[model samples]
Target: MAGASVKVAVRVRPFNSRETSKESKCIIQMSGNTTTIINPKAPKETKSFNFDYSYWSHTSVSQNYFKKDIKMK
Candidate 1:
C-alpha cells in the first residue's frame, strides 16, 4: 500500500424518506478517487419522526434472519 494515492474505501448512505412525506434528490460526485454525496433536492423537515437507519434497518434484519436473499436492497 506504499504507492496508494486514493482512498481504499468509499461508503454512502441515502437519506431515509419514510420519516416525512417530502422527497429528496441526491447527487454523488467522485474525483481523483474521492467521493462526495450531495443531496441537491433536500427538503424541509416539518414533523417529528423516528427512523432506524442505524443497524436495525430492514436490509440488516433480513440479512441476519435470512442470509440467502440479501442484495444490498
Candidate 2:
C-alpha cells in the first residue's frame, strides 16, 4: 500500500460568556481550508495556515454535532 498523507483540520470557537463580558474579539478567520489568525495587539501582523478542513462553530450544539460525525484514525 502507498503511503497516505494525514488529514488535519483547524477549529475556531467563539468567545464564551465570560470572554464576551470582557469585550473580547475574534481575530481568526477561515476561508475554504485556510485559517488566518491575526494578532489582536498588532492587527497588521497576521499568520495563515492550511488544513484539510476548517470548523467555525460558535455554539456548543453545532460543534458537538460536527464532532460526532468525524472519524479519526
Regions more than 4 Å wrong, model 1 = 1-8, 37-73
Report RMSD (Å) for each prediction in the order shown: 12.8, 6.7
Q: Highest TM-score: give the candidate number.
A: 2
Q: Pick the lDDT winner.
A: 2
**Model 1 Cα lDDT, one tens digit per residue, 4-72:** 664234333545766335554334433333344444555342222222221212223333222232233
**Candidate 2 global TM-score:** 0.69
Worst lDDT run of 10 residues, candidate 1, spans 47-56
lDDT by residue (1-73, candidate 2, tens digit) is: 5997899877776778999999887777666677778898899999989888778675453433233433222
Instruction: Please estimate how well model 1 matches the true structure, expressed as its whole-model Cα lDDT.
Output: 0.35
lDDT of 2 at 17: 90
